[model samples]
Target: MKKLSALICIIAILPFSLKAQRTQKPPLHGKHWMAITGKPLAATAGAGIFQKGGNAVDAACAMLAATCTMWDVLSWGGETQALIYNPHTKKVIAINALGVAPSGATPEFFKNKGYNFPPEYGPLAAVTPGTPGGLCLMLARYGSLSLEEVLAPAMEMAAGYPIEAQTANSIERNKKRISQWPYSKKVFLVHQGEKREAPEAGEIFVQKDLLATLQKLVDTEQAALKAGKSREEAIMAACDRFYKGDIAAEIARGCQEQGGLITKEDLANWKPVIEEPLHINYRGIEVYKLQPWTQGPSMLQSLNILEQFDLKSMGYNSPEYIHTVYQAMNLAFADRDFYYGDPAFSPTIPVKGLLSKGYAKERAALIQPGKNLANAAPGNPYPYEDRQQPFQKLLDIREQWVENPGKDKPGSFVPKHDATYHSENKNEMGWATTKDLAVDSLYMDRLWRGTTSIEAADEEGWVVSVTPSGGWVPACIAGNTGVGMSQRMQSFVLDSILDPYNVVAPGKRPRVTLTPSMALKDGLPYLSFAVQGGDTQDQNLLQFFLNMVEFNMTVQQAAEAANFNSNQLWLSLGGTQVKDRQPRPGSLLLNRSTPDATRSSLEKMGYSLQFGDRTSGPINAIYLDRKHGSIWGGSSNNGEDYGIGW
Candidate 1:
């Protein structure tokens, strides 16, 4: 009788146990519009724009401006990469606002400085500013509002705004570096010579120069409009002022004074290109990402490979599932590190071949069933594109490097912004032996390097997803423009051995990790999403998409899901030495909540595991609920990412 009662008790608890747990934050529901971003105030800016009778593109521009002003891991001088879904055309378009290496940024220039890659910070690392022009182009082309209207929120914030703790603390912690540039020191060091030289949390940090600069753009636009220019022409006039007028003169002067390479010619020559995004069909859903210049296509490749597997049967977060995902990512990233680069440059990338399902299958076939493939090298995609392999010798050299990564000279890898953005505790550095801990910390820093994402959508079917980055804290403020210079030049490789396609060159965009994602089902917008980690952006995004599709989790649940990261790919940011960019094959980061059995199985499969409480992302996403005639918004609980829907 007692045994029967116990069985009944177990049966009674089963239903509740099987039910999904309540999320820490509720999903945002909206019928008219939804706006989500890295910072709460930035999302509020988007919401304000939405309420003011703006479309998704206008709202997104406002949010981008606000976030850049607020220094949400980016500034006005940073690059802006976006994927926008236009309801009118029923098409998705990509915006490539990535900055280019300035006039003297050749490989020999950096190699002569005794650096393997570009320096991690300072004026020397700056590329020509892209955000300003990109924002203007986006607003002028598709937006319903004027530049003044879209920039109002950001201009207000630029005049004066309460600084958040994260940015304030970052400024304080890196004050020594900030003090190196006179303009930067003037703007960021509000409490110079004090125990804390940066603005306190909640302090009203003012940037008078920045405000003046924004005012100049608005004034230029208004002047152009008064002169009978069309809205688009007026916006372009303001953009031209920044690139070719007095503003350009000041920027060039400032950059040169600070020992940077950006010239007025570089700025004037640069323009944001609207290109067709690359995509692959996974099951019935078509997903889109920026071209090879970004690491976006790697996720598509991973999805194509995983489509062949019975992922649902393997179960979510299971050892087999994680291993399979990891191996697929490894294979895709291997191609990314080798073949992905600015398409406008020489030695054309075999992108057609790389995105081929046949190519994915061939790569997927290399995955070991019971062990990690530690030496996964780049595969031949040229054949798939009907082209001959011209770099067979380079591929052989890459294979040798994969087998012996330690052949490169090892140096100390110090990631200055890790503490400021991620809030990593230095005390946790004691988790392993000093040497192992240093490697782990460096890998973690590279994996979780900072950026910010923006997602916005409207009832009219317009959607915008953006991943804008660079010019984080410890940034060098260029002249008196109050705009921090972009440190994106560091992502370039100084040697062909590191990345032949991404070798630093004048007028070439560095292959960046920033990527925005969008999905379409049956010729309609299904999901718009993005995240903010450097190398880990696509890794986290891949799992987030899978969580919603295969596992049938809510957008919010997927954003907060327990996803694992593979450290078996090249680092895109941080480190001045080649060793810092080398892959740490078999290293994996798993959520602390992972089952012990799964952990043991992964360990036995030759994986070196590391645990983290929050392993997934601060991913922001919007799912169009076509059936419900509403939008479902998801912002991860990991950070201050917030969304407003109404």
Candidate 2:
């Protein structure tokens, strides 16, 4: 009778327990740990690590490695950047695993080749890969697992994992390109030259060469350990093998043999750095992002500018919200076009000046409610400059390098931003798909390019947000290594002088599209978030953050919110810039969830609105309600996202 009564009591509480599991929306609540990755398999891998007593950092590494194996957009030879928030220290640190240009790299090199822009693929576009060293560094510093231990899951995954439809589609589309190289094809298409068909969704995808490459790093670490090295020392030696030793030599040789510029010295000299993040105080929330080299600070600048608006009162995705946000986006893009560049090549990046509150206020005054203004020019933030020289000639690099953005091209079938429309009703305005919008838009679809983003959090309040890009595309594998290389070098401009801030030169890093962000409120680490869309990354992230914080939306609701794709900046998606004259990029883009009435209102206001086919943003996030002591996590409903909590 006692056992029966206890069992009856447990059954009675089942509904309430399930109710506790799911609340407001897709962001499942939990008390302990949470991880949401770009793909389900990667999330499983991360969860496995977390279950084994690994902290957020270890799980993040495992997730990233698994993503690299499955997501063709990443490889062992790519780059990754992460923003880590340590709750104990309350400091968000930016980890730059981004590669720098080779020692022999020069802007004059591309210019002398008689090319208006650098090549988008192949060895010449390659940079010294920073991911290998960066991952090991993260493991050595924060993770409890050894480099070999954290990487084992990835090695197992690379050996053989089932491919998905998205990856399969990408592979089939690039079949011809990937077939050119024996090893590149081996990694993607199972039988190097024989089986040309794309692998089905359930087909096992094996990357033997990549597995070997990763194992070699472990082997190096093991050898170091056998030689009486400490765990940290062994990891450092493993990193050294990739950057300064045999691996560097092979990579350099490949670059040389393929008519590229990367030399061994470039790899040896390159070291990823940990730096202070650029932060802005937006409505009592301290938001942090990467440095200017990435499109990171654009978010900071946008938030600072948008801080003046009563966003909650304006309502989410309303005409006023759209108009205000778009104006702020344009202002931020104008500044990004002017000031963002490789921090190493350009030491005076005016980072502080650009992010200043007074500067944001001054720029905010430029937005007028009723009238849609023409392109906003970069503002004068010199008053906020604490550098040696406040006033400097704003070199017109855009005229030469960024000249072909085609901002004047038609952007939508409904009507242009020039607004000659007479109709005010919804039916008068014709509906258009993303493709239909593309017909009149200035932006052309850069065929099949996406990045990878991952986030992890533990009960201890330690959280991490990482964005990994530079997969280098379909067919280009480095020298003899089965692993591919990144065309990150394409981020450079062929200008060695005049533009001190972003001039492309040897040993100078390119301003990459990879930006990871974190947030803190009430002096406590709160959220870790990231996304895959290149230039649209920051814009998407901004919406996600605002949704959770301002509108009190659930994590999934926030991630799936209608995104604003502000293509106004040089977002540098997958190292490929749209090269044509048409309806230009930067026309305001909204996901399908935006009401047709809202779209019509924006159109009437002379805002050229573009439609995204799906209510999707390849964004993922992990939110910490510090006050509640609960964790909420969700991913973008793009099918690729996976959020797990326990």
Strongest candidate by lDDT: 1
Q: Give the least accurate 10-residue stretch of model 1, judged by summed lDDT.
A: 4-13
Instruction: Point to the candidate with the largest TM-score.
Output: 1
Clash count, one per candidate: 0, 7
Backbone clash tally (model 2): 7
Q: Which parts of model 2 have CA positions greater than 4 angstroms off?
A: 1-25, 192-197, 386-435, 438-449, 495-500, 574-586
What are the per-model C-alpha RMSD values against the true structure?
A: 7.6, 6.5
Tens-digit lDDT track for model 1 on 1-646? 1221221100011234434655667677888889999887888888888877899999999999998898887898899999999988999999999989999999899989989889989888999989998899888998999989989998999888999887787688679888989999999999888898899999998999889998999999999999999999999999999889888888888889989989999999999899999999999999999999999999999998998899999999999999999999999998889888999875488889999999988998998897898888888998998999888998888777666665463222223344212223322322232113322443333334368899999988899999998888788888889898899998899877667889999999999999999999999999999998778889999999999999999987898788888878878877787776667677787787888899889879978666665776778999999899999888776677888887
| Model 2: ten consecutive residues of lowest lDDT | 4-13
Q: Rate the local accuracy (lDDT) of all candidates.
A: 0.84, 0.70
TM-score of 2: 0.87
- Candidate 1 Cα outliers beyond 4 Å, as residue runs: 1-21, 405-416, 419-449
